[model samples]
Target chain A: MAGSGSDDDAFVFPVRTHFHAMARRPGGIPREQAIEAAESHLHELHHEFKEWLDQELAEIAKILPQSADEVTSDDPWVEAAHARCQAVRDTAATMGFYLVTFAANNLCEAFDTIRSGIEYPLDAIDRDFKTLLLARQEADSADRTRLQELIRRMENPSAALPPAARRTPSK
Target chain B: MTRENLNLHGINFLVADANAYFCMISQSILRSFGATKIYEARNAMDVRRALVEQRIDFLLCDSMLPPSGGLELTRTIRWSANSEYRTIPILILTSDTRLNTIAMARDSGANMVVAKPVSVSGLYNRIAWVAFHPRSFVDSPTYFGPDRRFKIEGFPTGVGRRKGDKEFSVGEEDGPALAQDDIDSLLNLARKA
Candidate 1:
């Protein structure tokens, strides 16, 4: 424990320097060698990563509403989907799947906007979900870029529409 | 001032996350750093159990841990008057690196916020930094954790706002201000020390 006085009293506790001694002990592996070993382990886990990603996508699909009519502005499913996407985003990048991470991050943002009371387009959500699936299937960077551009447009449809055809009125 | 390679052997680490894959990945990274003992926790209950059973040297927690988030767990640990684990080094792992999110993690008593998907080098450096540079814990009325301020060059007005802060007078300048390169070199020296 850091301190031993009353809760109301402000105090400063000294640093614990034991870790320094532990880290500096002899016979430790070299930094580069340890990193190389870890990278090898991650490579071995790549197959498992695909299986994990598949399970995560399936869970997201199961939790999200099937149709726009089924979703309300404050639907709890939206939050659930957001959390699932966040998990995917956090893991995909570490597994060397940057495109999947990007698509998942996009969906996470859309859910965040929806949760904040904005009326996000359900079609955009569907497209992002599809993009995630496609990104997992396709490894081409050009295709990934194209899919990301499409999702960006879907995220903000009014940006693609002309001034006279905008959906929400500009302030 | 030379840095030594980190040896995490014999250190007990607790990795808490709702996602099992994330926990596995974190474990892999820690193992790469020579960690031999690691525990996994999926929720608050698991975390509490692990804290009670193990003498955890480090904690890597997901920002959105289930059934009451990681921040809540951190606050509970920090506010617990009698808990021996109150001052454990907590590193929050999350993909959300927005400014507000980082600020919230800091306010919740975490020592560091690591953005995901975590790279091997990034994780290694963060762990080494925390181990090498231990911060003094500050016990205040509204806060109980590592001191939020990283550096204390001086307050803006040569005074602090805290109740116990002391007022100091600025000394008259005796020489010309150092050049930018000179300042940078000085800081680099200090960091190396």
Candidate 2:
């Protein structure tokens, strides 16, 4: 079920395949099998990550939304969404989709903490779920701008990143 | 928004900066603009490491690559490096706009030079225009814009009137546009992305 569920995620976030295709372009990829190179690698990513995300999605779909208007505070689906996004983010980072990986990491830090925390009582699970949904929605709303910035940087190295948000990896 | 690494293999964009919010927003926008992969590299050394490690299609370089000036770095890449790595198009953004400095920048091998501080909208269009329409663009010319000491108008042949239409066509003297390939690179880089 999880395997099939990630297909939905694969459909929405297709970074893995995009990266694979680029890597295989030139100065990369094996000498042999260059013939079917593009197709095979891209397809492989779609199958692996997307399928896993699809499964995660299926879990969310199953758990959340008791009825169109009846998603209660205790909805288990919200937790699933948070977890799925966490895993997806980790996977996206490995594949080289900067924005997706960053976003996924964002989701993990935001939702996963609350999900795992003992601070939120069992009775108030609804509040936690609401917070998760709200945060996710905010990120979703900003997706267009975020991704556009990502594209600009992709096209040219000299494009500026907002100075306030820039980070340096440690030595 | 936070992005995650996926299992699939493909292109990744790397943002080389130390500011966190700046990285987040820029990385996010880059994707919306059409990049599938994005990475972050802060400072000059990070940029070098990223270039060596990843198959970066694009880079978001800070004009202020601490310790060393970004302008100087562009010059090194242009003059010293071999073609394979040198092929990457670098867009240099500088805060100061001294005419002489801009001229030196052109010679340094920067594909395009943008004045800073750039508005987000301007940044978006500039990167998209250059990255998406690469073939149409070429090298940025050694333009020495207006300054008291050195200016395009100060040229021996009153080139002030040579701006806009007066310069390119001159009443149907149909030769190659501008007679300089570098200017074409600027026009193309600044063209609609």
**Highest DockQ: which candidate?**
1
Worst 10 residues of 2 chain A by lDDT: A5-14
Best of the candidates, TM-score: 1
lDDT of each: 0.77, 0.45
lDDT digits (tens) for residues A25-58 of candidate 1: 7767666787888888887897888888899889
Candidate 2 lDDT over residue span B1-193, tens digit each: 1111112134456665444434554554444333556787667777777778877765555555554767666655544435344545566655436565565555555555666444433454454334323322122233211111211222112211334524322266465334334443654465423
Best-fitting candidate, measured by lDDT?
Answer: 1
What CAPRI-style quality would you assign to candidate 2? Answer: incorrect
Question: Which stretches in model 1 have alpha-carbon errors above 4 Å?
Answer: A1-9, A17-20, A69-73, A139-171, B151-193
**TM-score of the candidate numbered 2?**
0.36
Q: Alpha-carbon error at B2 in model 2, in Å?
A: 34
What is the TM-score (0 to 1) of candidate 1?
Answer: 0.76
What fraction of the real A-B contacts shows up in model 1? 0.62
